[model samples]
Structure formats: C-alpha cells, structure tokens
Target chain A: MRTTIMPSVRILIFFTILTGILYPVGITFVALGIFPYQANGSMVERNGRVVGSELIGQGFTGDRYFHPRPSAIAYDPVPSGGSNWGPTDARMADSVAARRDAFIRKNGVPGDVVVPKEMLFASGSGVDPHISPDAALLQMERVAAARGFDTQKSDALKELVMRCIEPPQYALFGEPRINVLSLNLALDALEKGYPPPF
Target chain B: MITVSELIQLMLYALALFLLTPPLGKLMAMVFRGERTFLTPALGWLERVAYRVSGIDPDKAMDWKGYLWSLLSFNAFGFAVVFLLQFFQSSLPFNPQQLPDVSWHLAFNTAVSFMTNTNWQSYAGEVTLSYLVQMLGLTVQNFVSAATGIAVLLALVRGIAGRSTGSIGNFWADLTRSIVYLLLPLSIILSLFLVSEGVVQTFSGSRTVTTLEGVQQTIPLGPAASQVAIKQLGTNGGGFFNMNSAYPHENPTPFSNFLQMLSILLIPSALVYMFGAMVNARRHAWVVWGVMFFLFAAGVTLSLWSEYTVNAVTGVGGGMEGKETRFGVANSILWSVATTAASNGSVNSMHDSFSPLSGTVAMMNIMLGEIIFGGVGAGLYGMMIFIILTVFIAGLMVGRTPEYLGKKIESFEVRMAAIAMLLPSAGILLFTALASVADAGLAGLNNQGPHGFSEILYAFASTAGNNGSAFAGLTANTPFYNTLLGINMLIGRFGVIVPMLAIAGSLAQKKITPLSSGTFPTDTFLFGVLLTGTMLIVGALTFIPAQVLGPVAEHFLMLNGKVF
Candidate 1:
C-alpha cells in the first residue's frame, strides 16, 4: 500500500503538470503561431469593428439578410444547444409547423414551393454557422426584395449566392452548404460596392 | 433512401478505417513491447524523465495485485484532485468566465466520471468549469483514464501470452508508454488540425460581439481544440462546451467532423490489433475486429435508414430536428453510431430528436457494453470476457474442455468473466428501474411518455456502459442523478476491471496446453459468428424487456401517429 501511494501521488502530480498544464498550453502556442485567425475564434470584422465569428451564426430575423437555421438558444454561443425535441413529440411537430408557416410568410414564397427541413428545424448547435444550399436559395429572393433590388441586381445577388456556396471539404465530405455569416457579410460588401469578404 | 453521395462518403470512411488499423496497431504493439520506434529518438528522454521523477523503475514488473493496487491508488488520487479543484475553482486562476464553484454532489459525480473514463457530464461545461479546472482536472483525467484502460488491457494481453509467469506487467510503465507513445503524439497532431479548422485554442475570456442584427452575442473561447482532440482520440467524450462536437467552434468544418469521428474509434480499433500482436494471435485479432466492425456497420446502416425515413408522428421529412444542417442526416447518423459504438459519446446531433428506431440502435450499442470497437483498452477486454464465455459454451456443446490462446479456460476464469459481464448489465437495469420509480429521477425528464422513459434508461445505460453521450433531454444535474449515476459509473468501470484483472492473474499462473483436435478453435470465421451471436443473445436477453418499455414502444406508438 505504501509502495502504491508514494508512486501514485508523485506520478499524478507529474502527469498533472505534463498533460494538464503543458499539453494544452503547448497546443495554444502552436495554434496561435500557425492559425492565428482561426485560433482567435475566426471573428469576422466590418469597418474595424468585430461583428461575429465566421464559424458561428448570428440570429437574422430582419428581412434584408438571409436567415440561418432556427436556433433554440437564439444563436447564443455561450451555452449552445439544440431543441432536443424527439421525433414523436407533439411539441416538435408544433414547432416545425410554426417555423414552416413563418418561413412561408416571411419569405413570401409561392405555395407550391416546399420549405427545406433545415429551415424548419432548430440546429444541433444553436450557433451552427452554415445552412443547406437550398435553405440559402429559398431566402435569397426575400433578401433581394427587402433590400429593394431590381431584376438585374437580384440576378447579381443570385450570382453572389452561388459564389458564396461552399463545396464539401475536399469535395468528398459533408454536404454542400453556405456560411450565413460570411454570405451576409459579403452581401453587405456588395451593397457598399466594396470587395467581397471572402 | 440513402443517396449515392452519402453512400460514397460512408464507404470512404470505412476505407480509411480499414487502411489505418494495421499500422497504428503495429505502432502500439511496439510501444507496449518497449521496442525502439520512430518516435523513440524524440520521446525516449521524456519517458525516462517521467520514470525517474516518479521513482518508477521501468524494469521492475508487478504481479496482478500490485498492478491493480497501483491503478486504484492512482485513480483515487486523480479523483481527489478533480473534486478538490471543482470546489476551489472560484479562487483558481484561468477562470476568465468567473464561474462559481460546483455543488458537492455534481463535483463528486464529475470526479468519478472522469477518473473512470465514463465522462458522463451532468453539468454544461461552458457554464460551469473554469479553464484551470477544465485543463488540470478534466483534461488530465482524460489522458490518464484512457491510458489506464490501455494499461489494463496490456496487462491482460501479457497474461494471455505469458507461459506460467506470475507477473503481468508494471502498471506505471504501461500507463506511461500509452500516454507518451500513442496518445500524446496523436493528440498533438489532431489538436493542431482542429485549430486549423477553427476550433478555438486560446487563454482568453468570452468575447462580446455585436452582430449585424445589432444583438450582443457572447462567444465562448478557450483552449478548446487541445481538449477536443484528446477527448476523441482517448475516447474520453467529455465536451468542453455544452453542445459538444455539435457546437461550431468545437467542430468547425466538415473535414473536422470526419477526422474527429475517425479519431474516436482509431485507438480502440487499433488496440484490437495490438491485442493480436501482443498475444501472437493475428488471426484471432482479426476475428474479434470482424465481429466489432460487423455490428458497428449494422448499427450505422439501421440508424441511417431510420433517420432518413420521414417521421410519421411529426410529418417531417429526414428527421432533421436536433441535427446540424452541415452534417445533414447521413453524417449525423454515422457519428451517432460511431460515437456510441466506441464509447466516445461526443455527439454532433442530439439523440433525443432521432427517429425512434435510430435512438434504439444508439441505446442498444451502449447496452451491448460498447464492445463494438468500445473504449480505448476497455473495449477489447470486454470483448475478451464475452469470448471466454462463448468458448466455454461451445466447449460444453461439443463435450470438450475449453481453451483460448493456448490456455485452458477453467471454472475460475469463466466465473470471473461472468461476474465481469453481469455487473454492468445488472447495474444498468436495476438503476433504471430505481430511477423510473423515484420522483427525483422522473422529474429530470424533458419529454413525456415512452420517449421520456428512454431518457432515464439511456442515462443509466450511458453511465453503466461507461459511454457518456446522453439523450440531452434528461436534466441530470440534481443530487439524486449525480449520486446514483456516479455510483453506476464506478460499478460499470471497476466492476468489469476488477474481475478482469483477477482473471488475468489466474490465467497468468495456469500452464499452457497445446492445441489438439478436441480443443475448440477460437480464431476462425465460425468462432467469430459464434462470438457475435453470444454477445447479441446475452445483451438482448438482459435488456430486451427494458428496450420494449422504452425505444421499441416509442417506435410502435410513433408509427400510429401518437406523439408524446
């Protein structure tokens, strides 16, 4: 027992310093050195003021901006989470129906066009940065109309949406999606006649 | 209903696993054998320094009792440090968030969870733990607890491979080698990659940013990438944040998601091959690996089918509730099965929102004891227990004595294996029953009816299997859950470990018998089938009634458009 206790305590202290203190702190240095922009939470800036992280979505309820997915925590990164609504839960159905109706009313889409499920459901991370391409496309007309874009400008905006569409990583992983924060930022840049954000 | 592109991605994942298994397994085998490797030039000095500072004589071997004593005492010390740190976190440095100290029961539960490698998080991490406590208490335990599992497995492997040798191995040496050689290098690489994918790694406080919509958003930032890497690689599964891998900063890109999923099973899968290399039974290792992969693929397939199908009750196509848009259905289902199968319970999506049968598959994966790739070191040993039982049963049918890896499988070995198998099963069922009947447990549920019942059963199954992913709907931070689940984590972890170590000791003393015609062959395809059948039968028999009450009933109720 004495043999076990002495070595156990010593080793625990040693590893605590090595793994707990050194390893993470060491990675911090490496990350800051190699990927400073990313390691610093990938914060996007506008006119030298920080707006939001490029990887984290912001709640976009205004008609002028393309909305991200429904957020359970209203896109709060501080305590991110999903609705965790079971598929069989009545509340889940109610929520989805409510979101669907809101999507149709807000976007003013034709009754024949079905809203994407991604637009209706709350994302797993309330701050999920990206939305499906279809979800993004569905909101493009609403965004264009709210910004008072004519047919030609709306066509240009559609082209910008296409440009903002990100392919899957290495073209073989995940789904093709668009980052809402980056896209909206790009939209602002285009409206200001400035260079695109990305 | 799976698309061609989704099917292609799944195939690519399988190919990556198949391709990477042997080399990583070989590297681990070399590390355990104390052979010179490519990493020896750089890491050898650190290993020596570790041994010298701790007064651990690398050459001094320990019998099973000595090894177990060392392991328990070390883990006990670890638990104290974690618990104490949580209590004093408000005064601790690096708490930029200025979070308050944890409650006593939650602290106790967390300490036990991490030390046991269960990582059943009762509290949301971003809201609770200081950076110092997260790093020193939880992250340190992540590395050591995982190394501890590997160490125990190495000891058992030595027992099987030894020729009447009393000593299994030195606990300190095995633990050190596992960390220094395998876990550390992989973590460094993966953490760096995760950072490049936008996982934050800094010593800063949460930043307040005003969005384009003119709303203030608090963005949580820390040395998250480093912890996220090890949490996956070590199969520890505790999230730095509440949403775990689902959070954008924790898993920033599709590439990061793919890699994190790969890392979850990488160590556990490679350890199967390490067991082969150590025991000089390559074919037998392949047999065990085959059984694990078969079950794992089946779970993924079932989950994909269920998740992709339209929900009857909710009238939603693709069951996208609680799933990220980037991952969609296929990637999310793949992660659900992989995380559960590996006992790496970091979720990219919430299980509570999964279609009924998909949730059932995830629950069943844990309830099968997580032996489908399982946790680092723990998975293989758990599988070995089932193998021993299978051999015993087969021997009985054939009217011959059972033998495995050239050693006779006698009554004592079989008894230890049975105890190892029964303890977790009994803990899961009995605790679930208690939680169901108790007001304290019933109050924690987020959904009503059968789905609510699943939240309790899944909580116990997750804790008892030492798989930490939750339904997330079970508000499990109360004193009642914290204490009971904490106790169950111990019962799940040590209950299997203590008996397995005893079996190693007994097996180490037994003389090896040469294989004969009468001896049952355990390294063949037939044996793999038999082993798979035995595991399913045992798991199904014990948990079927519980399953019928929870996920199965929910599935049927769901089909009839009855929403709870």
Candidate 2:
C-alpha cells in the first residue's frame, strides 16, 4: 500500500508543478516576448488612455453608435454569458418582441421593416464585439438621425459602415461583420480628430 | 433543410478529418508500444525522466484490479487537490485578481468535472477563479484525466490481444507515457501555434479600458493559449473564460479556430488506429473509423438542415442568433456537431439558440455515447462496449457461442459489458427525472415550455455522457445541480471505466482459438454497420421519450408558428 500510494502522491505533486507552474509560466514568458499586446489582453489604446480590448464587447447604447448584439449580461466582461434562453421560451419571445418594438420606435422605421435577428437576440458570451454587416447597416438610420447628420454626412456614415465591414474570416469561415467599437470610434473620428473624444 | 454552401462546408470538414486519421493513428500506436519513431529521440528523454522521477517501473505490469485502483486513487487525489485549491485560491500565488474561495458544492462540481475530463463549468471562469486555480487545479486535471483515459484504453487493447495472461500493463507507465510522449509535446507545440495566432498567454490581470461609448470595462486576461491547447487535445472542454472558444483570445483567427476544431478529434481519431495496431488488426480499425465517420456525417447533415431552415417564429433563415459571426453559420454548425460527436464540448456557438431539431442532433450525438471519434481513449472503449454487445447478439441469433478476437463472451464478460454500457444511461435518465421533479432543479431553468425541458435534459445528458457543452439557459451554479451533476460526472466516467477494465481482466485470461467458418469477422463493413446500429438503437430506445418531450416537441411547436 505504501509503495502504491506514496509514489502516486509524489508523482501528482511533481506533475502538478511541471504542468501547473512551469508550463503555463514558460509559455507566458515566450508569449510576452513575441505577442505582448495580445498576451496582455488585446487592449486598444488611443490618446495615451487605454480603450477596450479588440476581442471583447463593450456596452454602446447611445443612438449615435451602431449597437452590437444584445448582451444578456449587459456587456459585463467579468461575468460574461449568454441569456441561455431557448428559442421557444416565452421569456425569449417577449424579450425579442420588446427589443424589436423599441428598435422600431427608436429607429423610426416602418412597422413592417425586417429587423436583423442579431439585434433582438442576446449573444452567447454576452461580450460579442461584432454584429452582422446587415445588423450594423440596419441601425445606420437611427445613428444618423441621433447625430443630426445631413444627407452628405449620413452617406459618409454609410461609407464608414461599409468600410468597417470585416470580410468573413479567411473568406471561408465566419459571416461578414462590423466591429461595434471600431465603427463607433470611426464615427467619433469622422466628427473630430484622430483621438475622437466622448 | 441544408443549403448548398452548408453542405460543402460539412463535406470539406469530414474529408479533412478522414484523410488525416490513418497516419496519426499509426503514429499513436507506435508511441503507445514504446517503439522508436521520429519523435522518440526528442521526447524519449522526457519519458525516461518522468519514469525516473515518479519511481514508476515501466517494465512491471499489473492485473486489472491494480490498474483500476491506481486510476481511481490518482483521480481521487486530483479531485482533492482541485477542491483544496478552490478553497484556498485567495492565498495562492499568481492570483492577481484576488479571487476568494469557492463554495463547497461548486468546488466539488468543478473538481469532479475536471477530474472526470468532463470540464463542465457552472460558474463563470473570469470572476470565480484566479490564475492559480486555473493552472494548478483545472489544467493539471486536464492533462492527467485525459492521460487516465488513454491509459485505461491501452489496458483494454492489451487485454483483447493478450496471450493467456492476466497482466494488463503498468498503470503508472501508461499514464506517464501518455502525458510525456503524447499529451505534453502536442500541447506545447499547439499552445505555441495558438499564441502565434493571437490566443492570449499571460499572467497579467484584467485590464481596465474605456469603451468607445465612454464606459469603463475590464477585459480578463490569463494564460489562455496553454489551457485551450490541452483542453481541446485532451477533450477536456473547460473554457479559460466564460465564453470558451467563442472568446477571440481563446480562439482568435479562423486558422486557429480550424486548428482547435481539428485538435479536439486528433487524439480520439488516432486512438482507433492505435487500437488496430495494438490488436494487430489494422483493417478492423478502418472498419470502426468508417462506422464513426458515417454516424458523424449523419449527425452533421441533420444539424446543418435544422440550422439552415428559416425559423418559424422569427421567419429568419441561417440561424444566426446566439452564434458568433466570426464563426458564421456553416462553421458554427460543423463545430456544434463535431464537438458533441467527439465529446469535446468546446463550442463556437451556443447550442441553446440552435433550431430545436439542430439542438436535438447535438444532444443525440452525446446520447449515442459520443463514439463518433469520441474523447481520446474514452471514445474507442465506449465503442468497444457496443461492439461486444453486437457480437453477443449476433451469436444469439446464430445459436453459436460468442467470441471476440478469439475470446469467448461468457456470462461474466457480458454482465460487465452490460453494466459498462447501462451506467451512463442510468445517470442521464435518473438525474433528469430527479431534476424535473425538484423545485431546486426547476429554478435553474432559463427558458419555459419544452425548450426549458430540453435545457435540463441537455445538462444531465452532457454530464452523464462526459461531454461538457451546455444549453447555456440553465443556471447550474446552485447546490442541487452542482452536487447532482458532480455525482453524474463521477458515475458517467468511472462507472463505464471500471466495468470495461473488469472485462479486460477476464478477456486477458482467455486462450486464443483458431478462426473457423463460424468466426464473426469484425473487420467487415457489415459488422461496422451492426456495431453502429446497436449503438443507435440502444441510445434512441433509451432516450427517445425524453427527446420527444423536449427538442422534438419544441420542433413541432416551431412548425406551428408558436413560440413557447
């Protein structure tokens, strides 16, 4: 029993240190040298102030900005998660109805105008930073109206949204998407200088 | 229901997987047998060092009882260590976030989840656990637990091919070789590649940053690339962050996404060929691989169709809700089916928002024992159980004594095989029943109606099957789910393993008989179909009623244009 049990305990401890401490730390050390910006969290910086991570979603509720997907966690990065509501659930249907109604009223689009499903549905992570290109385009009217932009400004805004559209990853895998933060930042940059103040 | 593009993507994914299986499988066989190969000179020193350090005698073999005890004790130690780490994380080094201790039930759940290689997470990763717990507790279990599965598998394969012997090989030796030669080297290479592709690998704490809308947000950071590499390679599936592979840091580029998806099945797929090599029957391995591929292809076809069809309630096609656009619909559906089929439950899309029929397809994959290139060593063993049952049934029909690989299928072996097969079934059905009736279980539900029922069923199925993906609608942090699911994880993993080991013990003692006209050749296509059929019939018959109540009913409701 001693022979069987003692070696097991010692091996467990040895492997734990090897895998738990040395391996991850060693990898982190190498990553720090080569991919520091990403290894640290992909934090985007502007005007010497740290902005959001390129990978994570942030809350952007103002009508002047193109909204990302509905986040069940309200874009809380710490406790990121989806709504977890099933499609047939009454709560999900009601929430979708409410979001659609609000979106229709806010955007001032016709009642029959087809809304992008991503607008009404919550992302699984609750921190999805991208929305479908169509989802972003659908919100263009509301964002333009809120910014009090004229025809030329609205068209420029449209052009910016088009430019912001990221092609499907590798032109093979994902859907074409527009990063919400990037688009909103571009919106701000269009108005002012490169730093784009709040 | 599937579109042309979706079909193309599914076909391409399947083609790539099948094309790579044979060589990888043969390489794994060589690795297991201690044969000299290309990686031997480089990795052989690491294996010898591991043996020397652990004081494990690689030449000494153990009977089935010794192997089972060592496996159980080793896992028990892991569970204890993980549980203790969760309790003491605040004091642990590298905890830059200053995260506190975890609750008892949740800690128990997390420990068992990782130890069983299920990797189910009831709590969000970023807020609950510090970096120390993630590495020392969870990541360690990811390696050992996966190695444990492979070790058990090698034992079984040896038993099948043993010549009048009771010894099934040294548990410590197999476990060590599995980690040193197979898991460790692969993880190191994959982790480096993932880091190159922008998956995070750092000790830095969460960074506070301003959003474009002027809101201050904290973006969580950790040694994600390392963990993600092993999680997929080992089929562990626990996410470093709450979002799993969907979180771009965990899976940043399309190339990385493809790599991660490929890694999930790489070992499990190779193990089939390894089984053939160990048994000296390479043709039989191809037969089993064919069966698994066919089942996988069928599941993906159903899922693609279900996902592509326009929603009845929303009147929208391309089921984009709860899916990351970066992984689009086609890739997401492929991943959904592949993850479940492999019992590697890391997901790029939320299964909860998948159309009802599609969600059912994912559930069916797990419920069918996840043997379509299932988890590393666990999948082939699970498939072997069904193969045993298939041969036994065929023997009964022919009025002849049943034999597999020259070993007779006696009452004891059949009894053990039956127990091995039925244990997970019991875990799924019994727990689902308990949770359905209990107020505590009802409280965890996020949706109402049949979809809600499916959420509970899916949780139990995922745990009991040792596949960790969840429907995402159930709040499973409470003690009821935490403890119950923990029990399920244990029963699901070991219940099958122990009985399978006992069968190996019995089989190892049998003398080989010469093949005659009566001998049933398992290497044939007909036998492969029989094996697959037996698996599906057993699964479908056991779980169909529950399925009808959940996803099936929901599917019908959608067709009626009625949201729950």
Candidate 3:
C-alpha cells in the first residue's frame, strides 16, 4: 500500500504540472500565434473603440439594429445561465406570451403570420448572439425604417443583411444564423465606412 | 413529424460512428497490449519517461487488491490537491478574474466531482475557478480520472482473459499508456480543430466592450478550446462557461458542435470493440455494441418525438425554448440523447426546458446505468456487470452452471457483480429520497411540485451514474447539496469500481472451462435481448417509483396544462 501510494502521489503531481500548466500554456501560445483574432474573444472594434465580442449577444433594442435573441440573464457574461424554465412552467409561459406580444407590437408584424420560435423564446444562454436569418429578415423593414433609408438604400441594406447570413457550418451541422453584433456593426459601418466585423 | 433532413443527419452521425470504431478500437488494443502502433514512435518516449520518472515497473502486474489500492490512493491524492487548490485559489496564478477562495463544502464537492470523473459543477467555471485550477486541478483530473476508468477496465479485461493468474496488469502502466498514447494525441488534434472553428483558447482576462445598445458588457475569455477538447473526448464534461456548450465561444460553429458530439462517444464506443479483441470474442463484442446502439437509437428517437410534439402550455408543436437556435430542434435533441447515453454530459440545450417526455428519456438514459455508451472505460465494465446478471439468471432457468466467454459463473463473482450493480442504484434512490424530504434539499428547489422533484431526482441520478449533466434548475451551490453530492459522487464512482475489481480478482484466479452444448451463448441475438432486458429490469424496478414521482407525473400533469 505504501509503495503504491508514494509513487501514485508523485505521478499525480508530475502529471498535474504537465497537463495543468505546460499543456494549456503551450496551446495558448499556439492559438495566439495562429488564430490571434479568434483566440482573444473575437472582439469587434469601431474607430479604435472596442464594441463587442462576435461570439456573444449584445443588447440591441433600437429598431435600427436587429436584436439578438432574448437573453434570460440580461446578457451578463460573469454569471451566464439559462432560465431553466420548463415548457409547462407558468412563469415561462407568461414570459413567452409577453415576448410574443412585444415582438408583434414593436416590429409591427401581422399577428396572423407565425412568429419564428427564436423571436418568442429566450435562448439557452441568455447570451445567445445569433437569430435565424428569417428572424433577422422579418425585422429588416423596421431596421431600414429606423435608419431612415430610401428604397434604394433599403435594398442595399437587405443585401448587407444577406451577406451577414452565415451558412450552416459543414453545410449540415447548425442552422443559418445572422450574428446580431456583426449585423449591427455593419449597420454602423454603413453610416461610416469601416472594415466589417469578422 | 420528423423531417427527412433530420433523419439524414441522424443517419450520417450513425454512419460516421460505425466507420470510425474499428480502426480506433484496433489502435487502442495495440496500445493496451504494449505493442507497436502508428503513434508508438511519436508517443512511445513519453510513455517510457512516465514509467521511469514514477518508478513504475510497466511489466509488473498486481493482484486486484493492489490495483484497487493504487486507484483509490491516487484519486484520494487528486481530491486532496484539488480541494486545497480551491481553498487557496486567491493565491494561485492565472486568476485574472480575481476570484475568491471556494467555500468549504463547494471545494469538497468540486474535488470529489473531478476526481470521480463526474464534473458536476454547482458554480459557473469562469466566475469561480482560477485558470490555474481549471487547467491544473480540474483539467488534469479530466485526463487522469478518465484514464483511471480505462485502467480499471483494462484490469478487468486481463482478469477475464487470464488462466488461473492472480495478478491483473499494472494499474500504473495502464493509466500512463491511456493518457500518453490515446488521450493526449486525440485531445491535441481535437483542440486544434476546435480552435480553428473559433472556440476561444486564450490566457487573457475578460474584455469589457460597449454594445450597440450602449450597455457595457464584459465577455469572459480563457484557455477554453483546450479544456473543451479533453472535456468531451475524455467524457469529462465540465464546462469553462456556465452555459456549457450552449455558449457560442465554447461550441461556436455547427462543425464544432458535430465534432464535439462525435468525440463524446468515440472512446466509449470504440472500447466495446477493443474488449472483443482483447478477450478474443470479436463476435460477442459486436453483439454488445449492437445492443448499445439499439438503446441509443431508441433514446434519440423518443427524445426527438417528444421535443417535436405539441406541448399543452404554449399549444405549440415544437419545444424549442431552451435549445440553441443554431443547433435547432434536431441537433439539440440529438445532442441531448447522445450526451446522456455516453455519460458525456455537456448540454448544447438545457434539459430542464425539455418537454416532460423528453426529460424523462434523458433521465431514463442515466437510470439505465449510462451503458448505452457510457463514460470512457466505465461504460464497458458497467455493461459487463449486467451481462453477468443475465448469465446468472439464464443458469437458473437451465438448471446448470452458467458460463460466459468460457468462464463459469461462480458464487463469489456473482456476489461481487451484484454489489457493483446495486451500489450506484442505492446511492441514487436513498440520497434522492432523503433530499426530497429535507429542508436543506428543498431550499435549492427552483420549481414547484413534480418538476421540482425531477430536479432533485436528476441531480442524484447524474451523480450516481457519474453523468454530470444537470437539470440546471437546482441551485446546488448550498452546503447541503455540496456535501451530500460530494459523498454521492464518491459512492457512485468508487463504490461500484471496488466491487468490479473484486470480481476481476476472483475471475482471474479461476481456470477457464471448456464450452458445452448448453453454455448459454453470449454472442447470440437471444443473449443480447436477455442482457438488455436485465439492464432495463434492474433500472425499472429500482427507479420507476421515483420516476413516477418526478418526470412521469410531470408528463401527465402537463397534458392537463399544469405547470410546476
């Protein structure tokens, strides 16, 4: 027992230093050297001021910008979580109903048309950064109206939104999504010429 | 109303898994046998250096008792180190977040969880653990604990193959080789892929940025892709972010999501084939794999149907509330079933938001002993336990001594197998019952009535099964849950492992008997059905009452438009 214990403890300590410290540090350097932009949170900038991470959702309430999915945690990164509300939970039902009503009133969409599920439901991570391309398109008219664009500009804006549509990775994995942060950053870029957010 | 595209995706996933299993299994068998492989030249030096530095005689086998002692002591040391690290986290390097020391109970729970390969987090990672602890303390355990599982399984395999030998293979050798040859190389490739797909891998602190709405938001960053790789590949599912895989940074693109999902089942599923090659029972291995595949397919189908069916509350056809829209309904439901079945418990969607029937399927997958494709090496040994019981029952019906793979079913082996089988079930039931009635337990309940009961039930079930996914509704950070769950994780992991080793010890000492006309063929379709039936019966008999009190009742209540 003693023989096993001493060697096992020593090995544990050795592996801890190897895996815990050296491995991650090694990986960190490689990632930084090769994929620096992504490895460092993929932050988008405008006029030398950092705006938001491309990976996380931002609170975009103005009709001029397409909103991200409803965040259950108010988009807080430090303590990210889901609402964890069951479909049958009364509070969840109430919140969904409230979100649906708000979506109809604010977006001025016809009630008869089925609102996309992403528009009505709070995402798993209150910090979901994407809305489906269809969801984004539904709010396109409102975003164009908010920006005070003419028909020609609105058509170009729609083209810009189409560019923001990320195809399903591998052509079969996830759904097509428009990053709200990127789209809104593009909206800012339209007003002032700047490189588009990645 | 399952879409053709969803069916295609499922078919692709199954096809990919089938195609990948044999070569991986062959490579693993080579590793375990200390033979030459493609990776030997690259990783062989590390294996030799590990043994030399630790003074472990790679050729020296130990009796089952010695193996168990080494396993237990090593894990104990790991637990102590992790506990101490959390207590003194404020002083640790890489804590750019300036996190405080973890409370005593949480430190205890976290320590036991990682050491046991449970990875059940009561607190969010970025907020609680320093990067030092996440990497050194938790991530290190992710590799070693998973290696420990594979090590034990190797010992068991040696025991089955031995002829009157008292010694199983060296635990140290098995553990070292598993990490050096298998886990390390796989993790490096997977991590690089994940980083390419934009999963964050950095040492920088959280970045505060101004949003389009003009609100200041802080985005957390760290060495996430590195941890995410091993976390999924090793079947240790601790998440860097609190939202787990649902966080875009941790599982950014659909390609990343698909890769992570595939890696979860890769090792465990391959291990079944490895077992067959080791014991010279390739046919038997495929039969067992077939049984596991059937169960996995059934689970995925049930979850998909339930998720797509109309719910009474919203009067909606699809249950998409807690699912990530990028993964959509099919991917989320598929991920939920795969994660649960493999005991790789990182969720791309919240299980708590799943409709009752879907939630029930998730719970049932864990309750079925997580052997559809369980965590790393643990799943195969666990399924073997059920197989022993099936053979034992068959012996009684035939009025003859039962044999499996040419080994006679002895009293001692049967008793030890029973202990291995029952201990986790006991932990799940007793702890859940106690928590249901206790004030300390009730304090953490986030929902009312049946769903609340389901949360409590899911916690213990996850802990006991060593499947770390949670209902996510329960606030398990309190002292009561931390200590109780800590103990539960230990019992669930080691309690079963000890008896399994004992069975291995007993079997190793017995001489192999020749097969007869009535040896009860384990490779037959009837035996597969019988083995699966034994698993279902044990699970149903033990957990149906609790399931009724929780998800089962919740299902019926939801039909009546009742919300808990």
Of candidates 3 and 2, the better by TM-score: 3
Error of 1 at B103 (Å): 0.5
Give the CAPRI rating of model 3.
medium
- Tens digits of per-residue lDDT for model 3 on B89-113? 9988889989999999999999999
> For model 2, what is the error of residue A26's alpha carbon versus the real structure, in angstroms, after optimal superposition?
1.2
Interface RMSD of each: 0.9, 1.8, 1.2
Kindly report which residue stretches of model 1 are placed more than 4 angstroms away from their true locations once superposed. none
Q: Report candidate 2's fraction of native contacts.
A: 0.65
Question: What is every candidate's C-alpha DockQ against the true complex, given to 2 decimals?
Answer: 0.87, 0.59, 0.76
List candidate 2 stretches off by more than 4 Å: A108-112, A141-156, A193-198, B1-5
In model 3, how many backbone clashes occur? 0
What's the distance in Å from true for residue A134, model 1? 1.4
Ranking by DockQ: 1, 3, 2
Evaluated against the true structure, the overall lDDT of model 2 is 0.84
Docking class of 2: medium
lDDT of 3: 0.87
- List per-prediction Cα lDDT, in the order shown: 0.91, 0.84, 0.87
Alpha carbon RMSD to native, model 2: 2.2
Q: After superposition, how far is residue B53 of candidate 2 from its true place, in Å?
A: 1.6
